[model samples]
Target: MTRWVGPWLLLTCVFLLMVGNVDPWNVLVGAGVAAALLRWSGRWLMDGRPPGKLGPRRVWGFGVLALAVLADVVRGTWRMMHVILGPSPGAKQGVVEVPLGERTEGGARVSALVASMAPGSVLLDIDWERRVMRFHMVDASRADEFRADMERFYRERQRAVFP
Candidate 1:
């Protein structure tokens, strides 16, 4: 399932995005072309491209993560505005690492984007071996609190999305 669905979806998206056609008819045609090419030719199946076995729970889990990101984005935007308008420079920023699990590529990307967008944080690097993400935050004193918040947030919000 992983092999089939991931690549199939990727093909659909890349083709739809790159074909650069806005009309519905054009998009349908482009999708048809992409599907034909992908299903008939793509030759990596023998060596790699294992099928991804995403189940209902996995899709449901991602929906939760998506909502969390949306809420975080809104909250972060307002917080950033306050920091900018308030009579103070941004707080003392330092990098902090967050331990993560084997989340999907979309999950990883969203996590990075949301972390960067949140009020006082920005993604610095991802330590895959450590299964953690390094983020620069506005305040250093709150590192423990920040880490705790992230850990809690992911535990509650990500289980469904990436499960």
Candidate 2:
């Protein structure tokens, strides 16, 4: 039952988001489709595994993390615009290795998603053995600052949510 809950909730959210409105008929149809998809997919998506406990602290942490990610997205967009409009015709791009504090697969995936969602950064590779993520950044000069920010995010925001 616990194993089913996560998938159902995820699928339901996806369905609702896809439909984009709360019409009763739309919700009914979306639920049906979500259920069908979940049943057909079986446990392949999560391998019958339940997620970590979502206690109050973790939930709060998740909310904060979401807001932080949103802020990063906005900031990154503005920085990209500046880079494009500024005198610098060609910005230096390079890959930097950022060490990970949260080394779990889920944590790594979330970190990758967050990093890549921002305009200036893309995750190039994950060094599992070394517990580092290689990210290609638009401005190589800010690599140290970006690495510090990522570390701070994981330490302050993501540990509770992903641990």
lDDT of 1 by residue, 30-114 (tens): 6676666565445434245533457887777678777787788787777667767777756566788876765654455446656
Which residue pairs collide in model 2, if any?
none
List TM-score per model, in order.
Answer: 0.56, 0.69
Which parts of model 1 have CA positions greater than 4 angstroms off?
1-52, 101-110, 129-131
Candidate no. 1 TM-score: 0.56
The deviation in Å at residue 25 for candidate 1 is 34
Q: For model 2, how does the per-residue alpha-carbon lDDT over 1-163 read when each residue is reduced to its tens digit?
A: 5877777777877888987987888778877877765664454455755448768987888899999999999999998888778788346888999887755776776787788898989888888889888998888789999988888888888778864
User: What RMSD does each model have against the real structure?
Assistant: 8.8, 7.2
User: Backbone collision count in every prediction?
Assistant: 10, 0
Off-target runs (Cα >4 Å) in candidate 2 are 1-44
lDDT of 1 at 143: 77
Enumerate residue pairs that collide in model 1.
Answer: 1-51, 1-52, 2-51, 2-52, 3-50, 3-51, 3-52, 61-160, 61-161, 62-161
